[model samples]
Target: MSGKMIDTRVTIDGTFGPFDCRLDPRLCYTKPWFPLAETRKVAARTQYLAYKHGNSSTETIHVIEGRTDGPDSVHLIEGVPGRNGTPAVAVRIRWKGARPTATLGEATADARREVTRKATARRKAARSGRTGAPRAVVVHIDWCGLGEDFDEAAFVVEPSADGLYPVGAPEWRWDFASWWCPACQDSQPWHEVTCPCGLSRPATPLGAAGWNAGCALHCLTPEATSVLVDLDGSARIVDVHAGDTRIDMDRHAEPFGQAEEILRTALAEAKPGELAATGWERAPGRLWGRRYQITFPASRP
Candidate 1:
């Protein structure tokens, strides 16, 4: 496995029925498929046991991770990446029994979710809170109408909030929050908490993360990814610079993370209707799973 890929592989003896495997952290971190250090699994499953009928072994498979009541569900299990950048799996199973109407192509249609016998640790660890070092990022946008008027067209940005401005054209960002305020354009303090008028409820920008989780790596491609944080590790941000644009609504990031310390510091210094982007020159983007660059698009055209 490469350093920036999220994937898992399983091998099973047709007669044994279960496949057990564990991965090195360095390899597993590159994938969104992180599991517990140890896992017991069944690759292929079937309803009827052909061995009892003197034919031999029939394969059966069941997949379940993150428990029945968790938020993360297996969106899919494919043999490879689709036309778009989606998750995939390459599974090889053997079954010598019955006159089943199945082929490799047909098998794709039968993709099933697999379950792990010892999945308790994977479930809990994924939900646990972890803290890491503090990193900073800076976002610079050519904007106008940077304020909190709710109808100002956009919020002010930091680094240089000396002048009022609205962000790029509509559809540029689906939802977002600014480091500066529109009413009084100026750089905001490092720790001021911002409010988000997200899709449903009020999303609180505890710091810089966008409204949607996917936006965490706004400027990064998967090739440079390194880490993936749990849900509680980050907060949501809603940036409605114009209308409903994916580039606009998103989440902000901190280390594994630093919410309270950062939040407390920001709220203490920032005044009402104000904002600023920390550490000038770059916009934030996801790389290897965490936010690493502050001054984004260092190589933009």
Candidate 2:
């Protein structure tokens, strides 16, 4: 199944049969010099209609016309399979024209207003338990043609929160490259560590560690006082004691299944300063032995 658009005509090669339709003139508009200036006009003229085959047959279902204005361009037509499996389709026509520009003050004000509106809507949806529909996966096709000469490219479109999917186009917030913080629910960049709400980023493993280390310390008797193990396979360790640490086998030699055996042996036979004898370097944090938190690569492993 596939779809193509040439000027105002949209054609869909559906499962049951081919669908042909023309976009309403009101729903189509010239890309304006100032997008916001045309926002109200486009919003007022937006239309939606469903197309089906014979009256008795209920197999074919397609949204032939559903127009909406987006941040980048206007979505002229969007279609989704109804009951039977049909490929999702989107037709976006970007007219060749000069790019639009706006005054700094106008752009800033519009951005602020849009942010506030989206934030408010997200909060309301959270309270009402409405997360909207999940993004849809589809095949996107791009074509350029002049007379008989044309170039075409097609790629699979994976589901993402930032993209305008056929199923969730109406609800897409246009917050590209950003995510909702779990702590405050405010949208933040994916790379940001601390959110404006004063929440510190949670700990996550940087990458797979070559070596596995298990440390055990005993204050009295043979029983272990504190035992620490690197189970996450990350290169870093946090909130661990810096006493006699035992560097175990490389992760490849001994899988995590032997973690219990490794822990038992370290607690029973390992002693302090054994790590240094193996020529493994140690760089402890400010509170080294007391509240040890260090990140050192396991070069030998």
Candidate 3:
């Protein structure tokens, strides 16, 4: 499905960075002042959205109005810090047709507050075993435009799941990348891998997640393609494997297995090009204590 296309603008109050304030004769005969200003404004807005609502919430900036540029059109300006040698307060403006008058800062803040409020309420509802309301889940998805060659990544959180739990509760926390010990041919923790052959390997991306267990990047994954998983007998899942993706949630959020169950169901029903958030979970916390289940997408792919 197509995503929402909201208008946006960015502004930079100061003069600096690689931007040339003067008009450039290279791209076009038009003066560079207005174009440069618009560029800085767009940059600022993009950064602000990413910081406030994450990458998914950022809207596409339009240079020209595809529709009629009539009196009914309204413009919204967003202000952002001009870090990285840019303007002090870079502003981006969005021209939308028939919208209320509100500053981007005000709108963004209100939206963020609402998101937090809703997310908190959903979490509370889940904790209290309220089945009427849906459980929240967050996911990282690669969205492709209809005919576009590349994909855009979106990290999003939903307030509820379709059918909360026809699947099951989450009992494991799956890690996608771990280290593989060549000698043992088994997944080892990322920080350190000590093979029975007395061969010690360094940390690698495969097992990088193990660093939280007092494991260093080099000390984590010895082999480089494997990782340590929960013992099969411990959780509902037996073992986690490579190419398998797992859900990471807030330590204080998700009741442990609930998020996993929602993901399991969504994965079971998901079609190609269809990435669902299921709901938002927590951010990554400690690694060892967390249990993970192997994701179907990575497994099948």
Candidate 4:
């Protein structure tokens, strides 16, 4: 299918003593089906799978009371009632683009928290005068958030402070800290560190950079994206604003050549705070030889 194909749906409903719903062999090595591992288990057992995909989309799927043997098809085997005690379950598979399902969303959120925890732990470990080297934290830069206004941000994963990482929205505020409840085997923010079962856990310091970068990214305007790059093998974003020329966030996805020219011109001639835009404009050449232009769009429009 072409890239324009945004949404597709598939339904699988059947029962058998034992059968295999084989899939593309290439995907075995690729992680295209990841993040949905848990959801696939639920969907497979419930005999229902609903997926949706788009630039920014949500998904809803049913989870039945069943568990998979492994993260892959190897775990889907089980015993059957009859047929010489052969496996009773059957596998059905389908592929879809990256659509956020409840399971996948939860996984992403958990990953985000783990990343924050690891980064924070590394920073804390460095400051605590610990003997061991800080945890190896590798930050990933991506354009996330919802809608066309998606901006660049970083994420990484590490162990939870109390060795417990829960699934849900992360608490990344400056004052948020993680506390573990032994009774529940889960973690919570400092405010609710006390479990309903009367188990109260002590708070652990969260790294300052976690909340600092989060808050900074959130406060940036939608029209302005945080430009992150991997230069010299290290991921970093240098926030250097041109005095007179502003980066056009709308055209952030344009070709590399166009973006390079804009950057070159802005650096060479743009005064502080100057605005720039990228679009098509007629050039002083053959009638059909118009070229792309960069200038401020009409303010009134």
Best candidate (score: lDDT): 3
lDDT of every model, 2 decimals: 0.25, 0.27, 0.28, 0.26
- For model 1 the TM-score comes to 0.15
Give the range where candidate 2 is weakest over 10 consecutive residues by summed lDDT: 10-19
User: What's every prediction's RMSD, in angstroms?
Assistant: 25.3, 23.6, 20.3, 26.7
Off by over 4 Å in 3: 1-131, 137-178, 182-301
Q: Candidate 1 on 71-187: residue-level lDDT in tens?
A: 222222222223443323222222122211111111133443221322343356456742322111111111122122322321111111211112122322211113432212232
lDDT (tens digit, per residue) of candidate 3 on 34-99: 232334343444455445754333432322121222122222222222332211111122223332
Candidate 2: C-alpha RMSD after superposition: 23.6
- Summing lDDT over every window of 10 consecutive residues in candidate 1, give the lowest-scoring window: 134-143
Off by over 4 Å in 2: 1-107, 131-208, 212-301
Q: Is 3 or 4 the stronger prediction by TM-score? A: 3
lDDT of 3: 0.28
- Candidate 2 lDDT score at position 278: 32
Error of 2 at 213 (Å): 8.4
Q: Is candidate 1 or candidate 2 better by TM-score?
A: 2
Candidate 2, TM-score vs. the true structure? 0.18
Assess candidate 2 and give its lDDT: 0.27
